[model samples]
Target: MKKLIYLLFFSFLTSCSSFSEYSKETKKGFDEEDRTMVSNEAANLKTITFGDFKFATSQKEFRKLNKQKPQFKEILFYAKTTDVPYEYYVLHNPKEVIKNESFTYKDTIIGNSRFVIAVSKNAPRQDSEFIKKMVLSLR
Candidate 1:
């Protein structure tokens, strides 16, 4: 919780981002692996009801990854809110998330953990901005 807060706050310090080249990195997949169908999970996890931001549920179509160490990894959760033209992966690590604006949205923040969001090259700014807030505010 503390780490997530820090990351959200940390994103505001940068004046400009250099990771624009890798902006599309999240949209590509490994050729070595077979393509998996994208799905949504609206029934599995009990969602704490929010106002109008009833984002999509966690579906199997989404992929999740994390470290195996208990001390190294605290709590990790993966979800995406499709409120915009792209998908912003809301990854929550109880410990740390690697802070990299290059691999993330401008308004979005990263800590010492793995955070990935899927968005099209022509996604809208409003959609991208809202997704970040939804992820960070999710409790």
Candidate 2:
């Protein structure tokens, strides 16, 4: 009876440890692809300041539009109506509004729903020249 109890306890302990290890691995995998900032290579960056939130650099301001662009293709944001200082917000497709994890950034606060139009992350990051141009075009 004593040996049987010991075996059961050991088995339970091993199982708990294995479960934790598996959880850790899964979390790591999620973060590997989970990004919240666009890469520094997207093209067509146009700088239009809105309110107190000033995105000075075209590249820096891109983040204001798309939190984390995984590639050159489109990104999306649900913004407030008062967010953008220009008419570009009218260009967003109502259907393309993606699921933002309940985030309200400076851009969104102004009322512009954000979205990208480039190709998806199908090409190399270095070759994502499209993104780079967006960053550089903003004057």
Candidate 3:
């Protein structure tokens, strides 16, 4: 009886230790991925100040803003509209040097300037006012 109890206790301790190690490794992997995403976004972004908030702004300012990190070759600057469900985007080249389509506005050729564009889609409406303000600021 004594040996059986001791074996059960040892097994429990070993399982607990293994689970703890697995949890730590999973968390470390997630942290590394987040860092990599941030680094990639920074490398591709030509300008951080798309809307009212800048990526380099203070942490408090970032908390009050509504923007997403650069992803899928597009940087979303603001929230999507409810009526149309559209979000503003600033497209960028994925590669180091690649000639792409020039940014345009109302059929006018805006050259290769990286400008804001409204894309139709289902997105959260968190920063509508800020997006409008930014567009107005551009005009």
Candidate 4:
């Protein structure tokens, strides 16, 4: 009788531990799915706009359109005299920009305006088409 009870107890403990592991795995799956959904939604956004300010709007125009000062980090700047043809600035918010395989956001200033470009980091580095499109989109 004692041996039977011990066997039953061991079986119950094993089942409980298995169930705990299963629950953990199920929760992990759900979390991954949630992240994927959020990523997809972010990817679907084709335009970048902050309040009334939009990509390709001149700095002066931007100031007039937005009442509040916008926050961003400057990544690069190029002078008009340079071979680049346009005086540009690159800016980004490290917190909002995704550095992963999903996407990356870059703000490029050309002439007197700033342009926002989002590209998949996983894309081929040699692909100039995306850059051309972004530059052409600037007014």
Best by TM-score: 1
User: When superposed on Cα atoms, how far off is each prediction in RMSD?
Assistant: 16.8, 17.9, 16.4, 21.9
Give candidate 1's TM-score: 0.28
lDDT of each: 0.31, 0.28, 0.29, 0.30
Q: Give residue 75's lDDT in candidate 1 (0 to 100).
A: 20
Better of 3 and 4 by lDDT: 4
Residues 4-68 of candidate 1 have per-residue lDDT tens digits of 98887787643322122222222212122342212213111111212222222222222232122
Worst 10 residues of 3 by lDDT: 18-27
Tens-digit lDDT track for model 4 on 1-139? 9999999999885443101111111111112223211001111211211121122223333344343333233222111111222222233222343343444555554444343444444444433234424332212
lDDT of 2 at 89: 18
How many collisions per candidate?
13, 26, 0, 0
Could you estimate the TM-score for every candidate?
A: 0.28, 0.19, 0.22, 0.22
> For model 2, where is the 10-residue window of minimal lDDT?
18-27
lDDT, model 4:
0.30
Q: Name the top lDDT candidate.
A: 1
Compared with the true structure, what per-residue lDDT tens digits does model 2 show for residues 32-76? 334222222122223221222222122233455545432221322
Candidate 1 vs candidate 4: the TM-score winner is: 1
Candidate 4 Cα outliers beyond 4 Å, as residue runs: 1-101, 128-139
Candidate 4 TM-score, true structure as reference: 0.22
lDDT of each residue in 91-137, candidate 3, tens digit only: 32222222223212211112333334333324233343333232211
